[model samples]
Target: MTRENRRGALASLVRTLAVALVLLLPAPAVLADRAPIAPAPSAAGVLGATTYPLSLVDDDGRAVTIAKEPRRIVSAAPSTTEIVFAVGLGDRVVGVTDFCDYPEAAQSLPKIGGFKPNLEAIIGAQPDVVLAVRGFPAEIIANLEVMKIPVVILNPVDFTGVLANVERVGDIGNAHDAANTLVTSLRQRWDAVEAKAKGAAGRPRVLFEIDASYPGSIMAAGPGTFIDAMLKAVGADNAVAPVAGGMQYPSVSDEAVLGLAPEMVILGDAPYGQSVEALAARPGWDVVPAVRDGRVVTLSQREVDVTSRPGPRIVDGLEAVAQVVRPELFGPSDTSR
Candidate 1:
């Protein structure tokens, strides 16, 4: 196989693993039924304190009780790590997965494996609580529980779910004040983008490219995914949604993309060396409206991380999409965080 083929195979394997993990999660309807914990403001306008022995139903539909504030945390996913740090609990994070690279501080933390966690390493961390997302093996969770370690699984399906997870983490770490403030700021940013989108001239059809390493098979973000939600929230239509065949992430042929006629193309894989120039050079791709019109937008590494990761910065992802889809309405996005 050629180098491109190897990359394609690797990408396919990664996607397969991601889908398999997501399948382990409870249905979206089930998670939606569980109401998010609302933080109450104190007389001084700060969020009220969290009560000890806090009990709540996590996204995985499991009853988890945190006896007291967690002093040491183990994050099993990048999103979970971001949530822990965002809620002002970074100092308490003892271990993070190999994939967790944001916030600079997490980079120096001990690694607890990725995709498949290192059970021994996790145990060595001696964490007060283990924070994880969907896709972690059920057996691992059971093993941790048997060892008297609390595992909180957080799997948010949409924007609202992300905010709720942040609050939930705060509650576990007794950082309700920081979580409330962060959620409020995120909501304000979301509303601001939505207001701008409402004033746009018209909604444009956009294609979010997940991987373009293999020209024979192009991966795209489809319905029921964070990318799709961000596009819709910013008042743009997903060009691949109609032909996705119920898959959250689908591989499409060049013909299919041509038929979709996307007005704008967002390169979610730009960090991996994909570029507007490279895309334009592809055979027959130049005729595509987005390419011919030079409407291909390449996202930076930080942009890709914020857009793809379901964490506190997802609102930043919404704004990034808005800037690309409706540049006249929204200005350049801030990806500094």
Candidate 2:
């Protein structure tokens, strides 16, 4: 080959190789940006460490740290307040939202506000630490920070997350022993219920009624929801169609419910004394098999909330629901009823 021609060919080869390398190699800067953010170690993460340093990421993604155990704590969400008590931090909680109505002790505690908390009430309590769930408005979070109140947002949208939160609260409240015991007992109860469900003669079709008052106005767990996860764990078939419809809660037509004809109707346990009988009487509900066979089941509001709030109580809630969904599996000795 001529030198000039050979040189041109080699140049072309080099260009092709360079292009391949560019495509194959990842950009270091982008990779660095995409890396996971590691959580700082709480005492629970440390080997044999009893006292743990605590800090929680707020709703705005800001870190709120506590040097030691908080003397006075305020729970911004009703479920979170329940968790505080579940983790043995009830004495520390000075104030709770109006909806926190568990363990009886919580009802007597001063009320700050409801879903949208009042900043003035929260501040007046002078809480050293505040436990909140996700979706706290930016304005409220900003004001809390400006007033120098530390807000620790708990992420408990499922069973595992609930257990993790219990351990976390135990670590934060210096109630590690209680947390460990609670988690262990919770695991035991859950295992028993799960075993029963798996051994069940036949898993019944379940339709969870979020709002039975209006049979047409229905919300059910379809996919990626804690309720759906729990139902599966307890070996029940979810009647709601699982598809990519963002949590899969739709205003299902009466015709559709009638056609689906679930074996059992699972009613949400609401605070205002709601039941499946109410659902049965709703327009176009008399045809449902659950109503016809008297298989309508009522669960407590605490059993199925948006996020299962990572705690021992969630397992308790799961077992309670399982008892109703599959009474045969739970057996005659079942104390859940």
Error of 1 at 173 (Å): 1.1
Worst 10 residues of 2 by lDDT: 27-36
Write one digit per residue (lDDT tens) for candidate 1, span 173-289: 888788888899888988888887887778789998887766666888889888888898889999999898997777788888888999988776654556667778877888999
Model 2, 1-337: lDDT tens per residue? 8634543332222111111111121111110011111212232333323353566653346777776667788987665776678766787889887766665788899888865688888888988878877666678778887877777777555666667777777766776766776677767776777776777777677886543334354555566556677678788888776331564444456667888788877654233235544566677789888778877655433434321333444665576566566666553322333
Off by over 4 Å in 1: 1-47, 271-273, 332-337
Taking all chains together, each candidate's TM-score versus the true structure is 0.84, 0.74
**RMSD of candidates 1 onward, in order:** 8.6, 19.7
lDDT of 2 at 162: 65
**Which candidate should be chosen as best, given TM-score against the real structure?**
1
Candidate number achieving the greatest lDDT relative to the actual structure? 1
